[model samples]
Target: MWSFRTVLTTALVGLQVAALLAVLALTYFASQNVLLAYAEKLTERVARDTTTFTENFLNPADDAAALSQRLAESAVLGTADRAALERYFYEVLRSRADFAGIFYGAADGSFTFVSRDTSVPGAAYRIKTIETAPVRVVELRYVDPEFRPVSRRNDDADPYDPRTRPWYVKAKASPEVVWTEPYIFFSSQRPGITVAKAVRADERLGMRGAVGIDIEINALSAFLSGLEVGERGSAAIVAQSGDVIAHPRPSLVSAGGDQPTQRFAKLTEVDDPALAEAVASLPGGLASLQPGETRLTRFTAGGESWRGAVRRLAASRTPWVVVTTLPESDILGPIHRVRNIALAVLVAVAAATAGIGVLLARAVTKPIKALATQAGRISEGDFDDVPLPPMRIRELDDTRQAMRRATSWLRERRRENLALTGQLREAGRVLERRVEERTRELAAANRELEIANRNSNMLAHELDHRVKNLFAITSSLVALAARTATTPADVATAARGRINALARAHASTKDATDGTLAAIVRSVLEPYAGLEGFRLSMEGEPVTIRGANVTPVGLILYELATNAAKYGALRASGGTLEVAWRRIGDGCAVELIWSELPNEPVGEGMIAEPASAGFGSMVIEAMATRLDATLQRQLTPHGLRVVLTMRGLEEGGPLHGSAQAGGPAAGHSRGDAARRRAWTA
Candidate 1:
């Protein structure tokens, strides 16, 4: 007799395993069918395309052969005292639109040619002056009358003696015309195939030799390039000897970089262990030959398995083959994808099953456990507290009723237990009374500590406020002193400027804000705004700083601006003020520059340090220190420039009211007012 939980779990596990096996079986069969279909389709496509392409491109050889025969009979060759033959050949090559070039091989091992230079049109016929034994191309040129280049033959060229050429040899072997393997032309060293025919001169006509047309292999490359296979698929032309002839990847023919070779090599490296071995053993052009049948082969290369097929070319005389490959993973990819999806769903189902199992187990076990607990409690004289579930099985209901009766009988005994418990609780309360009083004392101490902390915070904030206010007042007092001094004419103006400096500093110290240091400087210079000879431009990031810091930086910029307004380039016509700032690492700095215009003759500066520091100078120094900044000032011919660096604020805190406002400093007294007015002026 299995328990309900065990029976349910076993059934669930069995069902899940069965479902997994079923899915796997379906996937396996489906995958096999899909791969078989894919291979068949691929092979059919290869066979059909190869046959169609060959039929379209390859013309009947009889026409070409007869054309060759006619050339041998033409006066051009019959008279062929080299010069006349050269001229005749040149005319023929030029007249024939499809003729890339014409090559005539002699029994003496010398080849002659007259052809249009496709790379250079309208060029004179390139004649080969062959004097070498056999293989060396002597003189190849494209030149006209005076032997001057229509196209001068390249001096260093390989000779292509017609007798040695395979196409010529193959043509002479048979009266029918035929195509030859890709070979370098002796005259140009260019890769191409030659269509040649043996000279079967009639006795009635003076026919000299065989004539061949060397068609550039690139023409076939163009032909093959037009075939568009499916994604990640490609086709190439390979010689019967397995040499890559023409491919979409032209670089494969070159020596250095081997992208095509690497691609093919990768195709050979598929991982379905069986597929990998099959491809390795398979040869090219096997599948496409049969048209309807597919030769499915898989092989391993680079440690992975690949699926591929090969078929023979129908019209190709060179025994060419077309080989195509795809990763086995690609052919059966749908099945794998399906399997993965099924597995994912199975995982979810498994998880859900386990969750349900836990819930079911708990549901069934809880009632039995509750009954046992109640029975134990009843044994311990807790009859009045017997617990009953909301619903129960019929057997459990009977059990509960029996327990209830037992409890009733034990009720008198429970009264005895309750009286004893009451006495024990009274003893406990007496013991806890002293401990509670001690705890209360500790709680009171905590309250006092909390109050002290709050007070300290308030005091600190108040101190910061006052100190900031005091510094501002002092700055205002300095401004007032300067304004009251009307002694030296130059001194008085300077004094007035000092007062303006104070006002500038005060203006920047608004309520509080964030990332507004640049704004503060601009606000300070606002009084000098719209001044004709001076132009003020501000750039760089805006940063927020403590109120204490903003004041000094603002003042420094004001002093610099005032000087520029009075004596620097800003004084000259077309003068401009450019102020820019940026953050450098942990700190930020601003450069205030005044460039003098070419409009006016500027006066020379004192060029010496001041004998005594003015209020403005002192304030700038103090502010720089408080803000932890570096101050630099230079009076160039253009204008006066001042740069100030200041510490920036951290991420979050109380909103800096004045910083963002770019407003005037608030909470100022009357003395501060007079100073601000004079300085702002």
Candidate 2:
């Protein structure tokens, strides 16, 4: 049979299990929200950091090209000093290892350069210089890493004109430094681009020259190759038009590699079946996208689902997207793992809780079952040989004791009824005696249960009384906090914060658990903290404070804090604040220092106190009196300095606080009943 104990326990435990499941579900969704936010922040940071690196790498080349342009406009190139020009190119090329060459072309079809020695493998000591004029000739030279020439010679080469070169034409058309299309250098046979700026010695003289630097594109490829995304995920930089500029995987951008026969490929033209399929899944062929736009798509690749994202590079001059792709397993594996772990925990807890409920129900029902047997014996009038067991339960034991007394009384009456029945001739007297004894036993059990019931009611009433008192006090504090306010917004701001502070004390211990003095200060300063870049520096050991002590402490700090925000460091952009505290005198007392320094200094006359006492001033002084600790205020040239020495609460827990915290429009409230009375007056 299902006993009352089993039903009640099952009902309670079932409700608890349902609640647990609800909480777990909420927790999972909340974690997903947090992790999604984290992932977005991570991607944004990666893009920004890469942008910084690219800018840093490229800015110097532009600066060097501009400097050479300025040098070319000077007399160094005006007189056509072949010797001076050759030396200048050599110095510039030697400074950067990746610089293929530095060149300067004149309007009169003359070109000169200092380029690497590509004629021999691993040759670093010598470089080639080619010059053209009335005669086209090439000079071979040796130089150190610092560009001091070691040897020089003139060489035979094909005729080349500076005016016919693409860079010279591009420079004349451009007012600022310009980058040319990527192409192979004649000397090195390696792909590169030139950064050039045009220079004129004198505009009226009609003498113009272009100074340029060629940077190898292979360096960019090497950099991009090192970047990675998630597991099995790779990043690639692709031009908006259609070209794949850089990628870690060679197959994605080229038919083969850095070879003469291999052609550079685009995302839309990869020969690899997997990559081709991935690109085909995109709605358009990568050209429809704009800068900073990101999109995700899935495609079947290598017999697995693949996820990829394409985001335009915000810093690239030409439209370029950074694409990251990986198999779905690589990204969703961890999420799946977390889900399985949560399910396991839920199952384990539910089983453990149900097991506990079953055991508890059995223990409770065992006693009640024994009591039921004793009640049956009394009802059947079987007083001679009745089975009655002792119970460990207090109430059940009391019932058993009552039944035993009833049995003893009926036995004595049965002996008297035997003697009287012989004279009166009625055997029903003994049965009547047994009925009377059973009724008395039932009445005694009822009285004992009533006493237990009264005790339970008294405890519940005490608990309710305490709860009501807390609410009444909170209501009073809220009302008092808004007493000085004239607007609804102001009243809301003031009343809400003080009430929240009281509520926080009830919700969490706040005695000592990592957040103590520092936390309390943050709660009071939160409103002012909303100002952009506004800072509140707090430093201290955890100060444990509790109970009524919070009232004076919260109120006192709020008063001083409101004043500081109104007229001190928080008012100016350049201003700063410092708050520090330390435990003192056997850790029973703590000394806290609050100091604010403004953007600029004020005169000594500004140190004077206020002309009239405001309500805030009255509250501050009133709470300060109750602190039973030393308080000092100093006015400096920069701002205000307030030092407080407060004794520890008589009984304190430890922690930070909980409050949604209104803005600075609302003020703090009177804490103690004594202080509230004075404020009202």
* Best candidate (score: lDDT): 2
Residue-wise C-alpha lDDT for candidate 1, range 1-681, written one tens digit per residue: 555666676578669867887978887887777785776577447545754565444453335445645766665445246666566566655555445576667656666776655355555556765654645557767765333466555564564566776767786677667777665444444445667776755655432456677665554556556665444445555554445555555545333232332221122322223323433476543333433333555566456556555665554355655555555555666777887787777778777786677677766866666777787787775677655885458887787788788888789877788899999999999989989999999999999999999889766764564355435544543444444455666455654565465455555543334336556655655644544444655554434555545455555655554454444544444665666655555343433332333245544552112112644465557667876767776655644556665554324422223223233333333222121211121
User: Over the full model, what C-alpha lDDT does candidate 1 score relative to the true structure?
Assistant: 0.55
Model 2 misplacement above 4 A: 1-25, 76-79, 121-132, 138-159, 183-191, 204-207, 225-228, 249-263, 268-318, 324-332, 344-681
In the range 1-681, model 2's lDDT, one tens digit per residue, is 566676866776678778877887787677766654554444444444554455566677789898888877776554277778777777777778878778777776666677776354434445544555566676677665566656666667555667777778888887788877555555555546688888876656654778888886566657666776556655556565556666665435554455655445755676444445545676886676666667666678878876666677554444556655666565556776887887788778777777777877886687687767766776676675466676667877788788778888887888898898796655577778999999999999999999999889755754564365355545544555455678989778876776676555433322323334445666655444433344566655545565556666766665555445445665445556777776567757777787877665655433233212654455556566786877788886667888888775434532222211122211333121110110000
Shift in Å, residue 208, candidate 2: 2.4
lDDT of 2 at 379: 69
Give all TM-scores, in the order shown. 0.42, 0.42
| lDDT (Cα, 0-100) at 111 in candidate 1 | 67
